[model samples]
Target: MEIRRLAGRVRTAIARADQKLVTFVQSHANLTTALVTAGLALWALSTHQSAIVLRMAAAGAVGYFLGLTPAVCVGALSVGFSVAISLEHGFSISNLIIEVIGAGCSAWLGYQHKMQKVRQEQAADPHAPQVLPWAVVNEIRTSLAAIRFLLFPLHDEEGSRENQALQQATQELSRLEALFREMEQRDRAGEGR
Candidate 1:
């Protein structure tokens, strides 16, 4: 009974720790990525593991491109440096090829991961506008162009009726843009909460 109780307590502690860890990672994703990359690079270098170094570099490049984490650059650079060191010992074309292939695959996977995350966010908040739909943006642009063309003759006049009308149209467009921006900000704030 004592052993069982002790095991139960241990399991509870582990569960709490895991929850905390998840929260920490979510809150400090960038820092976590950087630290993990550094640790991996250090391990690979210390072990003289060329494959590990190459894979890390590739993964880093992918993450960097996807804007997933800035630390990916550090990982890629560290791996490159490690590979150079290995080259000093013995130059192997096979190792270089592996590095290239690993980097390519990692980048592809990172891009896919980024797209998936974006899709998930959109699904979670259907009302939140991730981007202005192309058609709407194009319509706005067309309206602005028409307004400009119509008001071209009044460009030099400051107090004329045509000039005032032009200013009003421009202001209206600005207000619309501001409204979209405000909605996006509110959506982001809601997500944070």
Candidate 2:
């Protein structure tokens, strides 16, 4: 009975620790990535090993899912550290190129993965507004309104193909404006409810 009790206690402790780890990772992902990258760079610098370059690159790629800024910073640090170490050892151009290429590929892969995840989330919630912040959305709308005003004259210009295209564009813009208004009204109605 005592052994069973001890086992249960151990399991509970492990579960609690796991939860704490998850909470920490989620809340401080950017900081965590930065620290991890820094540690990897330091370790590579101390060991003066070329193989560690690959590990740093892998860390950078994985860091992408965390956040772009942190990942980029980490990638830059990794490359810089690798280069510094290489210069001290023998300054191999091929090694420097490889490190640079690895970092670039990691950054690109991470960006693509992040974008794909965002696209998937948007696709899953089609009714949701685009991922842009409200300020950016407002700016874009304002610019579009200006463009529409500029094109307004073209809409009435005599039977040229360009005028016809302009007319269609203006009509489409009106539809979009109506849609935005409707969306705003729906949002207000939702808030009231």
Candidate 3:
């Protein structure tokens, strides 16, 4: 009983810690990434070790995890740190050039990896809400409205039952389209919040 109680307490603590971490990450991802980058750079400088491959991999991973802009920033910071360290010792132009190229390339590679992952996820998630471009949505709506307008002329050219049915179907299409638009807007607003 005591062991179970202890285990429960541990689980609760772990859950709380995880929740806190999630909140911190979501709220201050950029700040956390920058802080971590600085810390890693400082560690490398202090160790007096040129961890080039490690730096490259880290930059790429950060890019993948954070995004393209942050990845680029990571590469920039890495280059900055490398320059500072080289200035302290005998400056090696060749090493600096390699580092510059490596950092830039790694960042781009990571961003590409991230984009691929996004595509894969979207492909896998069949039910995922697809957010179309606003302009495209507007264009489609305009086309539908124009079609409806053409179907519903001011002068009734054909008062046949088939014509009335077509008009009703178009009205139903318009209602459904408006509902879809309203739902999409709500979803977008919710995402922003």
Among the numbered candidates, top TM-score falls to: 3
Ranking by lDDT: 3, 2, 1
Off-target runs (Cα >4 Å) in candidate 2 are 1-59, 128-193
Off by over 4 Å in 3: 1-50, 129-193
Residue lDDT tens for model 1, 1-193:
9999999999999999999999998777645545555665565577677566666665655574645354355445655775788777987666555454444445444655677678899899887336767876887787777667656764455567776777867876786688678867987797899
Distance from true location, Cα of 34 in model 2, Å: 24
Per-candidate TM-scores read 0.34, 0.38, 0.46
* lDDT (0 to 1) per candidate: 0.65, 0.67, 0.73
lDDT of 1 at 174: 83
Q: Number of clashes in every candidate structure? A: 2, 0, 0
Cα RMSD to the true fold for all candidates: 15.9, 17.2, 12.9
Error at 109, model 3, angstroms: 1.4
Candidate 3: clashing pairs of residues: none
